[model samples]
Target chain A: MFDWLQHFADWLIFTVFNIDAGTKLGTALNFFVYDTIKIMILLFVIVFIMGIVNTYFPIEQLKNYLNKKKLYGLEYVFSAIFGAITPFCSCSSVPLFIGFVQGGIPLGVTFSFLITSPLVNEVAIAMFLGMFGLKATLIYAFSGILLGTIGGWLLGKMNLEPLLSDWVKEILKLKMQQTSYQKEQQTFYQRLPEITRAATDIVKGVLLYVIIGIAIGAIMHGYVPENFFNQYLGGGQWWTVPLAVILAVPMYANAAGIVPVIQVFVAKGVPLGTAIAFMMATVGLSIPEATLLKKVMSLKLITLFFAVVTICIIISGYVFNLLL
Target chain B: MSKVIKVLGTGCPKCKAMTQVVTDVISKHNIDATVEKVEDIIEIMKYNVMTTPALLVDDTICIKGRVPSQDEVFTFLSNNE
Candidate 1:
């Protein structure tokens, strides 16, 4: 009777979920379910916590503490560390950037957030671990943090304030208007709904993108040709990094969406550097991300952001190729 | 009826420049039009554009994926008008 009940349950689950019984489809379906649940729940939890932090911590205090121009290097390090822990995409990171700026965080420090947010995220880390193992994931994560810190500090030192749009400057000027409304003054209990609302807003905004990204990733995993990478990007030629970056520019997809493609490339014996470059290009500098960034940044700053990220990805890819 | 032109982006400089150029062109031609900037991603995505710095005139996508020169934009506006 127990055996029969088990069989019945299996049949019910298979029919309802359309899960394959025992094949790659089954494996893929299991992976999808596990990954989706893990990602969504993790995202909700982290964002909720961050939202609470945002609400109660008073970015103003943090900003006031770090506002000295000379301490910009330390601010960059802080931003990079925070960025490494928070798994935000380019589009998702903007609101946080606004929060940081409105909170009076330095431009370069906020830039560190922008830089590391998408490039090295928890989702990317998990996927990297699952696909490429722990060593690669650790290296990628560490390097990403380093890059974010250095890039932000360097840009901060350049004093590119002149390149800012008049409107942004205007917005900055108006920052003093709301200095009195401090959310942090509220008790933690009072801030719960605010945290919930912020998390919900973030999830609502980003969930669609995540679904689309995962769907595309699943499709690529199941359908794309194994040897396609070998045919297109397998050469050890020096120009492949730039070529890959150029190819990735016009396309709009996220890191999760491109991981399956990277897996295929690795499986097909593409050089590690070239494949990493392609992944970074597609994930870090997507068209959608650029479009989203256009709302807050000026053209010159946007161009600089793209250039810096692309160069970093290329360098990282080369390093990976040399070492591994 | 005045034509409405919207520059869609995240309020970045190029997006601002695009808005400026469009406004400049409309004013120079004495065309009765309202130029606005759309910074919301969902609203921008409604037009099926994957790139930023896009221009929309009368709710139609006129230029996409690149920042247009002032003359190019004028020609676009005039041709559409």
Candidate 2:
């Protein structure tokens, strides 16, 4: 479908710079052109659709659904899935967490949403498809959801709700007072322009990341040695996984924002598993997010959440390296 | 015309900060302005502000993607006026 764009890039590089197709410069230019257009188009379309769909899917339902869970294992599963589709960031995750707790959702189930939402979302999936292909993306999505479910289930058994902050308890008391709050009926007419605005806003925000990521990836594809990172960061080295998680914890970037960096890392021969671990760590367990959660959660629960998720990611990284 | 200041977000912390900044600016300046907080995801999209905590003064996007301090809000309202 994008063959014409690829050809245009090739011809431009050859004609303008007199560089042949086989040369390193030509290859880099080719990669940059092809990927830039591909990822941007995919980002706009996917984010637009997601925006429209998100408009229709009221968040109140999520709170209500988790609150009324009668199914045995399905609540955790569904919460993880819901976490993936929600169009908010780590910033929104806190209030959503408080909302869930106040709505009577289990703390474990809430944890499941908090962990998975930032790690694997629609933007991440689209970017991965443009950069890494389907298999790696599936691995990321699978591990993210699984970690949330298993982690939440285990934490549920521990029953850590007593550790919630006093402010949250007061909020629950107020929610009890407002027991008969009315729900608004949604209409398609009301959602149409809002959807377009969302699409435009998202596209504007991430376009630069896509460009920068593809640019660096292309440059790395042409210039970087194939074996540059093989000795230390490669899949063959088991410690690289944990090492990546540790390094990534302090960095702050959403999945979309960090793709270009991930592209450069992977292209320089960083193992896919190690690279994914880094990405998850940057998005899911960053310092700011932990600080925000501290507003409502005790230090012990926050520590446990971080420790459990970090361990899960490090383990998944090792498993992927071994399998792939 | 009373200036309309809309803070675009889903009521997150950053959004609250933006809202507070606008409120303080308005009261501090004694300006005739209406401050509205748009928490609905779709309503936020209407302004085409990607990051939450976007501030709009009379339909012009003045600040976005981060929280603005009271001084910044003061400057924005002054400029709009």
- C-alpha local distance difference test of each model: 0.64, 0.74
Error of 1 at A244 (Å): 3.4
Put down candidate 2 lDDT per residue, A1-324, tens digits, no spaces.
667877777777887777898899889887888788778877877787776665456666667877876979889988887887776756666667776776788899988888888888667877887778878888888888988887777788887988877766666566343222223233566545545655666677777766776777788788887778776577576678888888887666545756766776787778787878888887778787887778778999999999889888898888777777
Runs in model 2 with CA error above 4 Å? Answer: A179-190, A254-257, B1-81
Lowest summed lDDT across 10 adjacent residues in model 2 chain A is found at A177-186
The estimated TM-scores of all candidates read 0.58, 0.78
| TM-score: model 1 vs. ground truth | 0.58
In terms of lDDT, which candidate is strongest?
2
Q: What value of lDDT does candidate 2 attain over all alpha carbons? A: 0.74
TM-score of chain B of each: 0.88, 0.90
Q: List the residue pairs that clash in candidate 2.
A: A213-A260
